[model samples]
Target: MDVTSQLEWHPLLRDPTGRRTVKPRTRGQTMVIDKGLGLHAFEDLLQTSAPYIDLLKIGFGTTPLYPTGLLKRKIELARQHQIAIMPGGTFLEVAVSRHTVPEYFDMIGLLGFTAIEVSDGTIEMERTVRNELIRLSREAGLTVYTEYGKKLWGSTIDAEELVETVLLDVQHGAALVTIEARESGAGVGIFDANGECRDEELLDIVGKLPEPDLLLWEAPQKQQQVHLLKTLGSGVNLGNISPNDIFSLESLRRGLRSDTFGLELSP
Candidate 1:
């Protein structure tokens, strides 16, 4: 370690209880959802929370809405900081629905995004289509993460269906399988209307998953994040996080905050 590498001071702070795996991390992944950040805020997010962020998804088909040059620069910036960035799964679904999968890949690859999300939350896709999308994205050298569950806010997890879907998804080459809690994290998937987690559903899935780390829970709210962190422990993979909450979530995960202090983590 080089002491001279130290530079600026923020303030006196509480160090997190346990050491987390640094970049190229396998567990405890955080995926920030970029809705429509301007160039300055995007740069600031990278400068501030790059260490805490593993993946960045430009949420909900907003990738194509960015001016091409700016989008490419954002992708480049995230990659420079060792963060994987990709468009929301729904965006790819739109391409798939429109029979533009090849063109979408060409556009995405040319723009230099490092990953892809394959999901059927909005559009009902056949199993073959889902697998092919996974294969196509991987063949194009993009990391593929598949998502399960409907977008309806009050839809609870169908235990057996969710389990089987995730198992098959991993078999078809999904790097991470996300439970569809939606951008609001309320009234959908594993959460209730007020964004509270369904404990029974959560336990069943986490307790049985072959590799729990491969499942990213979409928790977009503060209270939800705290609840999930306390419940699942430090090694959980969380997604759909608002860009502004990056450091706050990291603090909660590391027990640097009051909410999760003295919590125990799973191996």
Candidate 2:
């Protein structure tokens, strides 16, 4: 039986966002960034939050820091839960910087990762190189999720450039394009230095995007998630979520939380 089918909530108390598409969803997706967790803790997160997680990112260069067996087991666990797993783009950026892109791809395949995050946050990458990386990831049977924007403090969205990048990325077979807000969700991409949304910039980017669904806003903070959810609607794809915030974010999405309670009364 579907786990949700076992729920017995009264109709009036049901999820305010209505029914979210279950696993294998193409939208309203949540990507969790796992900084570091022991095997037991990882298992607990999966057990409690698997149904709500669409992707698990073993954040940054922590991939090689894990004991090989533990890392592989975590990949396997994510696979079993129908969630995609990938190393953070910073690791790939390092490979790009080190001229070890081939080795990086090989390691990803060997590690049994089902996804790849192609980002240019820290390094400058040509469009041709970006296209090839996306293609290579796709050829390797990995789901390719590319990211837009820079990681520098006070970095902000360039709406026109963003549209161009998103168009080319998805055209080259990238699955989704994440907007870089980093883990802190402050002073980067669409956010201001204080971790607040620069609403004008956000609106500009959204208005200019050819396909808004393809952009996964990296809103790691609770307020950022709420802002994006309210501004972009509940169907927005959000990335860089901390594992502990998955259920809370879902509540906000479903209008089960006070921050989004108005959704409960919407027709």
Candidate 3:
């Protein structure tokens, strides 16, 4: 049974924005970062917020740390809820560093992951290698989400470089190019040190992109999420969200929160 079907509120009451897309949504997608929730917590999250979640990333290099049965069960529950589950890009980076790409893919396949994140956040990767990873993941039948920007603090976006990355990544079969904001949402990519959005930089990138929807902005902070939603409209894809903030983020997207109240209703 669909979990959301249990909600009995009228349409307007349930979604004041009236423009929020349902699950299997092309836009307004939410990607949550799972640091290490216990099995019961993970299942509870799916049962409650599955409809709002599009992607579930097992954060960092922790995928191999969970007991085999526990990890497999988490993946199974996410699949049952129609969420795309994958190990974090950093883990793939670890695999690349160790020359274990084949082993990495095999493990994820055996564990039933539905997607992959290709990123060079902490290491240097040649464009050829990056493209090959995307192709390999695609050939293996997993959805690919490529990420741009370094993970270092104070890192910022270079519009020209980002444009090239996005265009080439999509050409190589990546479903979306994520702009790295890390889990802190501060001093990285388009955000300033205080976690505020650098509006001009953001606009420059958005203006240059042929398809802005192909990019997912990682906004883990409430203020950052509101800023992006209000500026880019509610349909902008967001990532790196924390488990605790899932429903709150959804409320903000749908204008149920004060920060974005009557968002779509505004002129």
Candidates, ranked, lDDT: 3, 2, 1
Instruction: Give lDDT per model, in order.
Output: 0.87, 0.90, 0.94
lDDT tens digits, residue span 1-267, model 2: 699888788754667566666778987899999999999999999999999999989998889999999999999999999999999999999999999999999999999999999999999999989989998999999999999989999888889899999999999998899999999999998888889999998888888876789989999999998888888888889999988999999888788899988663112
TM-score of each: 0.93, 0.94, 0.96
Instruction: Indicate the residue-level lDDT of 135 in model 3.
Output: 91
Pull out the clashing pairs in model 1: 153-187
Candidate 3 residue lDDT tens string, 126-201: 9999999999999889999999999999888899999999999999999999999999999999999999999999
Worst 10 residues of 1 by lDDT: 8-17
> Evaluated with lDDT, which candidate comes out highest?
3
Residues 65-146, candidate 1: write the lDDT tens digits: 9999999999999999999999999999899889998899999999999999999988999999998998998899998889
RMSD of every prediction: 2.7, 2.7, 2.7
Residue 237 lDDT in candidate 2 = 92
Show where candidate 3 strays beyond 4 Å. 1-7, 265-267
Candidates by TM-score, descending order:
3, 2, 1
**Greater-TM-score candidate between 1 and 3:** 3
lDDT score at residue 251, model 3, on the 0-100 scale: 93
